[model samples]
Target: MAAPDPDPASAGDGPGPVALVIGSSAGYGLAATLVGLRTHRMRGLGIAFEAPETGRRTASAGWYRTARTAELAAGADFAFLRDDAFSDGVKEEAADLLAARFGKVDLLIYSIAAPRRTDPLTGEVHHSVIKPLGTDYRAKTLVFEDSAPRIGALHLPAADGAEREATVQVMGGADWQLWIDALQSRDLLADGFRTVALSYVGSDITAPVYRAGTIGAAKQHLEDTARALDARLGDAGHAHTVVAGAAVTQASTAIPSIALYTSILHRVTADRWQTPVDQAAALWSRLTGAAALGLDDQGRVRLDDWEMNPEVQAAVRTAWDRADTDSISTLADTDWFRDQVGRLYGWHVPGVDYETPAETTVPWPAPAGLGVTTHSS
Candidate 1:
């Protein structure tokens, strides 16, 4: 689909650029939305697949909606759309809504992660499994639910080429293309606009489960999508994917052995810098206008500064190599652990009173259920 004709708002004319964030109700998406509003001073829209009534404890955190609406009250024209992007009808509905509300958008961020996907091209639904490549793969997996550590072997399902390709089609480029196409069709993109999708190139040790796994294949497709978008933008605008830092996120929780990685990441980044928020501030700065806004060496945004830092990477590698059950537990600074979790839900913030009931309600209209049934569309 081609972009709609350039409207008056299609030109960058105001401060705090208009933005849209897909999957912005929790974790990294929520953090990005908050940073854009509070730090970058941008007006925006947020879409999430999970609603408060979904009854998920993590999804019900009123802070997610609160942050979005409060930003609107602060003179930023904002809207919240709730729907599953995987569903075509829901995606179209969101596109129509955006077209009616704001005829043009200046920025878009795609931050979504799911385990299973229904391929539109093929009549099959694919589910992802994370395990060691060979049979002899064992790691210390942290039991967050029980607050204990146990060693176990992870066994992943064998992959079929059709299934792997389907996974990429559903989880990678298709949905992003749909959203951008819809926005363009409705005349919702301003000239010189930028769109970014979040991804990760985790440490080499996790290459089996992350960088070269099913998720890795999906990320590669996403990177390709970014490049395609970059080409589509031509000289009018730019689109790039960013390999962000390995912070503790809900998505990170699903990856096996990520706890150990995140533990070391927390320690290294905190010691090298002050907090994730500090790194996030720098990240948002580049996203907005702080650093020269452009792609890095990997043809993606270089937001993974801490992860790519030579010292930080060396330290994390050393920790991963030496990581055992007890060492993994003790190696990570607990103070940083508590701080990272607190920051996840906007707790322990400096200016915000965590004690007071300062309006934690906003509209989230999607299902927070990670267990969506995968069926071919």
Candidate 2:
């Protein structure tokens, strides 16, 4: 279970420090940024991509989220950059900003999830795809339709070398390493700096489509990069991947054939359903608690411990074997999933009036005196 703060929302009376987060607009990044600022009293430097508002569509959710955060932050020092992390210029700009404002960054969080990536120097574009690697693998999927969760038709897809390569190019840890290198080269990393990137290793049920799929290939590279980073940091800095629980996120939904398993897993672990915020608290406590950066045998942080419990996995397996459209709604907590997905979009939250008219537009936290370039697409 995650140890939520005594008061999750406050002025962060605890000892305050400085940290930087990449992909801080939503999901793990947003939750981690909130925990750092509100729970642990950390000054924040956040980077995320938010498309500019136009005539038809509103600004992205991350923009509104950051605006809300800035409103709730009572005199906190958190600056956000709306830019691309894959760009070398952005990395350099962020490094310079850290050097000027924070002097040093004690914690670094990497949580970028993009469908495509372009090399900063080479201009090569890589697009990620999800498919079973070698043979056609069919798995049951779940869909939310008619106001209930029902098992979807079986999905079977096979991958080729091109698909696997594309997935790795886009999702791999190479850019993470580049960011770390950029900071280190500029002396922005503080002494004993701690850096973590979010990752996942799900149950065997979706291995053919997830754990052993192309995304899995990218995760493997991510872990490998962590090892190299650990070696580089030596004793002064600690860097590794934290294997988070299987939860609904924009990224998770992009993967194929995970819905049935996830909905069932949620019901099996309902007693401990961890949102990204919950995961963030657990990770922060583990990092600053009595323990000193403990790792599982795989040399990674194990936030997925509760999700990976043997009995829980057994129950999920049992559910998986018998689950179908007729039995899914009965077997899983689809309501919880519905609520969470709604909450992700800033709806169905308690204590907020949904009927009242409100303002959603807020200015991005561009650096003072730096005019931001807004592109509408």
Best by TM-score: 2
Candidate 2, 1-377: lDDT as tens digits = 12234454433456566888899888788888887776777775888888866768777777888777655555667787878888898887787777766788888999988989988868999988887788887877778777767776666678889989888888889899999999999888888898889899999988888778888899999999998998999989888999998888767876766666777889988778677888887787766653556698878998888888999999999988998878887787777767766776777787889999767566766544333333223
- For each candidate, what is the lDDT? 0.64, 0.79
Residues 1-377 of candidate 1 have per-residue lDDT tens digits of 01112223322455567788887766566666666665565665777665353334444453365444454435545655655666666556666655665557888888888776555446467665544333334555544435454334455554566656655765677778777887787777898888888888877767777777767888889999899988998987788887777766667767887766777777777665423344445556676575675567768877666577788878878876776655756666544554555655566666776667764345442223221221121
TM-score of each: 0.77, 0.92
Taking all chains together, the TM-score of candidate 1 against the true structure is 0.77
Q: Which residue pairs in candidate 1 have backbone atoms (N, alpha carbon, C) closer than 3 angstroms, thus clashing?
A: 49-366, 49-367, 50-366, 50-367, 50-368, 51-366
In candidate 1, residue 172 scores what lDDT? 77
